[model samples]
Target chain A: MDLFYLAISSTFVNNILLAQYLGHCPFLGVSKRIGTALGMAAAIIFVTILSAIFTWSTFTYVLRPYGLEFLQTLTFILIIASLVQLVEIILKKKSKALYNALGVYLALITTNCAVMGVALLITRKELGFIEMLVFAIASSVGYALALLLFAGHRERLQISAIPKSMQGTAIALVTAGIMSLAFIGFRGMAA
Target chain B: MSKTQHIGATLKAGLWQRIPPFRLVLGLCPSLAITTSAENGLGMGLALAFVVTLSNGIISSLRNVIPGKVRIASYIVIIATLVSIVEIVMKAFFFPLSEQLGIYIPLIVVNCIVLGRAEGFASKNPPLISMADGISIGVGYTLSLTLIGSIRELLGSGSWFGLRVFGESFEPLAFLILAPGAFITIGILLGLQNLFSRWRGEKFIQS
Candidate 1:
């Protein structure tokens, strides 16, 4: 039940994209086309979960045992950067199809705060391995769900007549705002 | 132009030409996440200013030493180290604000604005101009966040920086402080920024 609550809570009630506001750049940047949005979503889920696991283990086994908590930010970022590079190289060598789909976004993932945010969040919450995995998966799923939904809106928005000043990100953001408002309706479910 | 004048021009450009969160559309996370209240916005902005400025200076100073192939990684390491310093300092000195900011303080390492400035301006420029660029951009971001925060605070709670800005008869718009409000507020602000640039007869700067 606790794990269930964690999943629902992260997925809906406390959505990383809508509520917590992590990864807004891609949320706004790549949500233009449904195809790219889907690709970005898949890449985000894959990398977010992987980086979360790596950072969690590093913190638990390495940072915590020592008095190097101050180095947490530095270490986690390096881990994530190198990990993203490593993933990209291995994916390119092993699976061309998968790499081609996720390759472009892999570079962008290094700077995506959502990956880094989840890593830090897991450490801060100190969830066990299982709980941490659940939370990471749930949060990234939440991110993907938001991205897809917003992409659908943006696709239609492409045809809609928008104000001259509100043509691009401005309109997309307002759309995201309304979506966020709708997500707030789920606040009581997990709680 | 003279050297000092050229540096001044760079600083000025950072303020208006490449102003962040609006012009650059960079650093959206903290700009949207923590700007619920004026004080929080101000605190976050100042913290970001400190990080971006220091990182820009450091990156500029070492631009030649970092190889092009590994520059991005080197920049991240330098930025992450600086962010750690900011996190520790905030934790030690401003406990409540740091607590409020939570993971964002650490997440500053990934903030595109910091890295963006490092790559775009700092790597090509000298340390003095880069630092100035950092200060101007940081100040611009600070102002934008504060404006967003002030509007939200005033509307949501009838207060500005914890001081009541509206009379007792004024009913607050509670939605402005909620998750949706952050997005809507920034969305509208970005629109206004577009309109302002248009009025100035300048092309809109796409992020």
Candidate 2:
């Protein structure tokens, strides 16, 4: 029940993208098409889970013991950057189609603040190992939900008569703002 | 390209031509998130400027030795190292500001603006020119963030930087402080920028 609540709240109420506003770059950039949005979401999920596990272990095992907790940011980023590279290589050799689809998105995920945000949130929230895993999965799912929904809206927006200046990024941003307002409805439910 | 002209152009490009957030749109994460207040925006911008300048200088100097295949990974390591220095110094000295900034202080490592400039501009240029580009772009980004924060803060709180610029009768728009307001404000700003540019072009042609 606790894990279920965590997952639900993280997915909607405290959504990483909408509420916390962790990964807006990819949320806006990649959400133009459902296919690309889904691909980026998958990549985010994969990298978030992997990076969380790695960061958790590194923080608990190495940094804490040596009183080098200050190095958490630097260490986690380096780990994430290299880990993405390793994932890219392994994916290329193991599965061509999967690699081709997720290939470009993987590189971008290296700097996707959501990935680092999860690591920081896990520590800040003081969650256990299981909770950390659940949070990572839920956050990624939340990101996917927002991305797919925005992509659907944007597809309709392609035809809608928007103002001359508000056509591309401006309209998309307004749509996101409305979507964020709608997500506010999820608030207080967790309480 | 003429070397002298190229150097001069690259130096000025960071201001408007190659603006980090508006033009390249590379570093919107920190640009939008930390700009809720002018002070926070300045703090974040300065921290980023320091990081970008140092990393660009180092990366440019070491560009020859870093292999092409591992360049991105190498750049991350270099940037993460510099970000650590900033994080430690901030925590040790300015504890309150560091706490307020929260994870964002450390999250600077993954800010694509810094890494993007390093990889795109610094690696191919001389150290002096790369440093200039980094600082100029950093200033441009800082100015943009400060502007966003001031606009949001003023409308959201009926105050500028917490000074209560508006009179007691003023009612602040609660939405501006919320997530939606950030999006709307930036979106409108971008649209206005485009509109102005288009209008200017037409005027120039008419004359």
Best DockQ among the predictions, by candidate number: 1
Residue-by-residue lDDT tens digits, candidate 1, A60-160: 99989997888899999999999989999999999999999875888999999999999999988889999999999999999999999999999999998
lDDT score, residue B193, model 2?
A: 69
* lDDT for position B134 in model 1: 92
Give a tens-digit lDDT track for model 2, residues A40-128: 98999999999999999888889888998877877888888889989999999999999998969999998899999999989888788
For each candidate, what is the lDDT?
A: 0.92, 0.84
Model 1 chain A: lowest-lDDT 10 consecutive positions: A98-107
Give the TM-score of chain A, superposed on the true chain A, for all candidates in the order listed. 0.98, 0.97
- Among these predictions, the greatest TM-score belongs to 1
Model 1 ranges off by over 4 Å = B205-207
